[model samples]
Target chain A: MPKFLIWIAALAALIALPHGLSFSQQEILVFLTINVLLVASYRLLTLTGEWSLGHVVIMGVGAYSSALLTKKLGVYVPVSMLLGGVIAALIAVLLSFPLFRMKGFYFLIGSFAAGEIIRLLWKRFRDPFGGAKGIKGIDPMPDFSVGFYQFDFFEPTSYYYFAGVVVAVCLWILWRIEKSPVGLTFHAVHWQDKLAQASGVNVRAYRTLAFAIASGFAGISGALLAHYVGTINPNAFDIDLMVFVLTWAIVGGTATFYGPILGCVVLTVINEVVLRELGLEQMRPLIYGAIMILSILFLPNGLESIVQKLTKRRAAGGAPERSPAE
Target chain B: MLDLLAQTGLNAVYAASYISLVAVGLVLIFGVMGVINFAHGELFMAGAYAIVALYAGLNVPFFLAVAAGLLFVGCLGLLMEKALFRPLKDNPLGGLVASIGFLMILQALAVMGFGVRMVHIPPVTQEVIAFSEKVRLPVARLYVIIAAIVLLSALWYFLKRTKFGWALRASAQDPEAAALQGISITQTARIAMFIGAGLAGIAGALTAPLVSVNPHMGHSVIVTAFIVIIVGGVGSLEGAIVASVAYALVHTFVTTFWDGVLADIVGLSLMLLVLIVKPTGLFGSADRA
Candidate 1:
């Protein structure tokens, strides 16, 4: 079977298994599925070493764009969803030229500032995004099937399947990049940008492309979220939201493709299950912040790296600390 | 038109004062420690809440509360360095991530201590100096400006003249070399944390009454600080101050004439323009990213 077939089959299994799942279980599955897509999308950018802070904003753009188009313009849901991702990616590309120059934290800061600006813009223009009140009454995925056969998305299990499909496709795309030449270039830009530049990499172009791809994924996630939740709020795309997405990548680890999905799924579950039970709605951020601090101090390289170290330690038992002359 | 310009000028100066305080601290901490304090805004929030606890609740003198706020938050910074940032010194990202955690902890504590509703501190004074009926300068704003001038001047003097100040600057400029020259990196880190967190605290204490005081107020302040520092360049003290003043002026003036949202747009556009024309900022050198 082709690699794409494996991806499709994997996703199909995920979708089919939800047939007998409970409502709450289905919701959890959908959220986790969407988070995997979202995190992978974000990983696409971080893989290039850009540290794009505006990533949540790109998701916001996607969520709000598709949500608005479907609500007001009455466009087909699938097309609007695709359009949302496309618009967000296009905007990211246009903004990337001015933003991509500053390396490291400056790029992060610039992207953050841009995200704030976009958020304010969305809030300021009341006609389109429904102002602070937010656009409501989005039609959840309709049962009227197109050529692919219609299905009901309002039911929790069906939505999970929808989410699962998207996640599968995104994961495939991301994994392919990881194994491809572009992934090699991404490492070149990340680990040694100066050396890569000297070695004839179009460092600027690649960074821009990475950013656009990341934004595109965020858009895809946003669309999925809007369809699932049936409403989109501007508040969902601000710093808090941005930080929410970032927590996954940071806590899970940023060094590999699997880390962010691991982070998103773990945290999202914790948020839904443990946090709600504890009645710590107001203190959720406190928990998040504390985790961040402890993670930095003890797990600086993040959980993925930590796991690798542990596995190596358990496997090797003991070895002399190795250092090469710099 | 005259009144409008003068009003904008006053607003600009006020914005410049607080933002410069926050930005300068951010730079100082980043310079010395090689770690960005994501919780710097939380320090500012802690300052404001120090006032909320003291001046607003206990009816302490405003200036006294402000002083206490500075000292308390500065001490908190020292504690953070000793406990958190110091252990993670080998990993700057670790330090930064730890700070982010601290930011959440602080926010949570604030929420638990004080509910999330906006707390209105009775204005320190209602007195205003009038250029015209609409062109009024609140006496409270004058306090921020005067305090900025005196404090910044003293900081400059200390940085340029005093032996400890020289040690601090030396350590900031190059820690390994400073260590070779007999300066202690650990001591310098303590000093930087205290000074940096103190500035943010004081800025917050002074401005607490002007804006809505809430647990989440640190959000915008940090965002503003990030923009200022990036515009000022990562590691330049003078650049941080200059960029802060310039950004505040443009943002405030635009906010005053137009709306708050548009001003934000313009503030970011200014950042973009700076990045394009002078990526190092107005007074920045390009060593730190």
Candidate 2:
């Protein structure tokens, strides 16, 4: 009953949180909400024990598909976003044939190569992709009203609330998937592919499934960003952004479901709120870089381990710690 | 048409020279330490910055600046070994992340030291060795080609003939066994890092005056190097060189005939093809992958 109350309080805080912030903070909140989904989806892919460098590109696939569908085909924004994820998943499925042939370091490099090819294609084809400048003047989410509150898409707070709900639902689905039998198979594939294969677990199929599902969620995150930001270029989804996602995953630690989410939130708070307030805009990357190195060197297991330790201590004291799913 | 083709061919050779320098160093480091140095491109950028400071800013002799670039960047590599790679030796992924952090730090340092704009270094020489109306090779480019050949030959000799070279190769093959045989892994790692980083540094220094120098200039160079090393087969020095030449030829021709963006696409696609057909790379043994 206490756990349920905590969940209600947290959701209430999230709902009311953006209201207390300035306009810019609200904007950052919207992005943070989207990024939580992005990083969470990244953790899903990592669960299969293959770290791909092409994830951002797959996200781009979602953005581009959604944006094009709305602009050219006159599809509704929400439906287009869903189709965007489907397309991204389909692309991941196609890419897996070429990419999954290798493992470990080879997979990393190969995925990068595949992603670069996709970005170049976007750059080369000016007709649909708008060349290097990318698609601009994207359709925004249309405003709607419930009995209690009216959603004004133009306001950052409205978008934040919208994105938060989407992310919360997405996180719920992801948590469900992770706890399912399929998720167990993914873990099996990650730990020992040979043993899993011997035990009738189709290692390749599970890997593909994880990749597809992860890409689907990543696509949704991209779609959310596209509608909110109203612009995205080939350069927007480049390796620099990919590096940030990687840093979040590593710093947050991927052992638990909430690890990357914790990483994304904390780092975003540090980078956006703290750094901006301090006016260290130019030195941001340097400071961020130093933080990354220090964390990897000292906190190699990531911030999640710290959480785990605290939880374990609490459990030992007879008061059970909160479940990560909550 | 033939003259144009000849000009592009010469251009390709020059491109091949500097690319092989960077790719070979990356391969050497990966071979010995088993860690991909993501900061390698930043090291190349540092080499260029060395020239920008010494040769261009201080008006020192160009050759001296080039030499300083090599030494300075080589020392940077040693620092990386001591500070980052050494402690994280058992964790390849951790080492990779650390290198990325290091890469960001270098890039930020460059940005702070030399703003985000491109730095214009005065040309070392304007003399063009013209073979025909269309075919021409600048003396500056000749310097890069000659230096690549000389330095690579010296590296080959060092690896093939020297006792330290034997130790480096032995450690690269199997660190535990090599250590058991009394070859110090630390000593070999330092030497490999130095030579590998020095090669990249020299390549950057040689090409600095020819290309626009900037903090982010390493981005494309590292990408090209990655493609070359992957195509050549990881851990194979000879394969890196060969793949560099082949990649340069294809990329230069595509750029000449089509466009730069198309050329990049062709290069990446070629890499993907190589990866799909042979995950271990074109010249790599099956066990390496």
Best by lDDT: 2
Please list the residue runs of candidate 2 whose C-alpha ends up more than 4 Å from where it truly belongs after superposition.
Answer: A317-326, B286-289
Predicted candidate 1 versus true structure: per-residue lDDT over B1-289, tens digit per residue: 8888888888898989998898889888988888889899999999999999999999999999999999999999999999888898776556766787788899899989999898889899998998788899899999999988888888888888999899998888778999999898999899989999999999999999998899988888887887788788778878888888888888888787788888888887777677677877777786554
Displacement of residue B215 (Cα, Å) in model 2 is 1.0
- What CAPRI-style quality would you assign to candidate 1? medium
**lDDT of candidate 2 over A1-326, digit per residue (tens):** 98899999998998889879999998999999999999999999998899899999999999999999999999999999999999999999999999999888889999999998999899999999999999999999999999899999999998988888889899999999988999878877887789999999888889999999999999999999999999989998999889889999989988888999999999999999999999998888898889999998998888997988888786665433323210
Q: Which candidate achieves the best DockQ against the true structure?
A: 2
lDDT, model 2, position A111: 90
Candidate 1 lDDT score relative to the true structure = 0.82
Docking class of 2: medium
Estimate the lDDT of model 2. 0.92
Clashes of each: 3, 0
Provide the lowest-lDDT 10-residue window in model 1 chain B: B280-289
Task: Give the Cα error of residue B33 in candidate 2, in Å.
Answer: 0.5
